[model samples]
Target: LCYFQQGSQSHSVKHYWYTSWPDHKTPDSAQPLLQLMLDVEEDRVESPGRGPVIVHCSAGIGRTGCFIATAIGCQQLKEEGVVDALSIVCQLRVDR
Candidate 1:
């Protein structure tokens, strides 16, 4: 984890690196990744005033998209008892 001031002095940034993830494929096990996402969510909840939680991969699109979709899907499953992966992907695609 690294923390530094953003452009403005009033705000700062915290970046967490998961170097274990491969460049072209998903991890063999999802537990650690899921835990990381949960940790990030917990941090967000604890710091409601903080900026957006930025998650990304080296290439910026493929793995980034997968991580985002998984996070959203997990949230949906927890809240609504179902995971609409297709909808999440579609929404992400539209947003992207």
Candidate 2:
């Protein structure tokens, strides 16, 4: 966890890691990754005023992009009954 303070206000940031994923390869199972995402989402929901989550891997492209895309897609599916993966990936690429 990281702590930041400004005047009398203080905040902390915690990092979550997924270690089952192999180097330069996809995870053996999506279940663990999905559970991790769900845990992160639960944390976000529990902390109403928390800052946006920051997700990253070594290169901040391949796995990072997939994580973000999946999270967003899940949210979209919950709210809109569909996932626009193409658009999400395109936007993530453009933003990157």
Candidate 3:
């Protein structure tokens, strides 16, 4: 976690690191990563007016896109009772 201040504006930053997952391999189990995502969503919910959440890893969109697609799909499922994974993945490609 970190904090930055500039001329009366302040920002609180938090980071989540999952190091056990290898660079180019799928995780053995999704439990840990799912827990991490829940924690991040909880934090984002707690802070309503903060800036965007940043998700990244050592490389590129492989893990980044997976994490984001899952997060969004889960949210959509909870709120709408359905998960449009294809739509979400397609939007991810378009947005990227």
C-alpha lDDT of residue 38 in model 2? 97
Measured by TM-score, the strongest candidate is 3
TM-scores of all predicted structures = 0.85, 0.89, 0.92
Per-residue lDDT of model 1, residues 1-86, tens digit only: 45566576555566778765788866888887888888888988988978788977888998788889988998999999999889
* Per-candidate total of colliding backbone pairs: 0, 0, 0
Candidate 3 displacement at residue 5 in angstroms: 1.7
The candidate, 1 or 2, that scores higher on TM-score is 2
Per-residue alpha-carbon lDDT of candidate 3 for residues 55-81, written as tens digits (9 for 90 to 100)? 897776888888899899889989999
Give me the candidate number with maximum lDDT: 2
lDDT of each: 0.84, 0.90, 0.89
Which parts of model 2 have CA positions greater than 4 angstroms off? 1-7
Model 2: how far is 33 from its true place, Å? 0.8
Cα lDDT of candidate 1 equals 0.84
lDDT of 1 at 46: 89
TM-score result, candidate 1:
0.85
For the record, the alpha-carbon RMSD of candidate 2 to the native fold, in angstroms, is 1.5
Winner of 2 and 3 under TM-score? 3
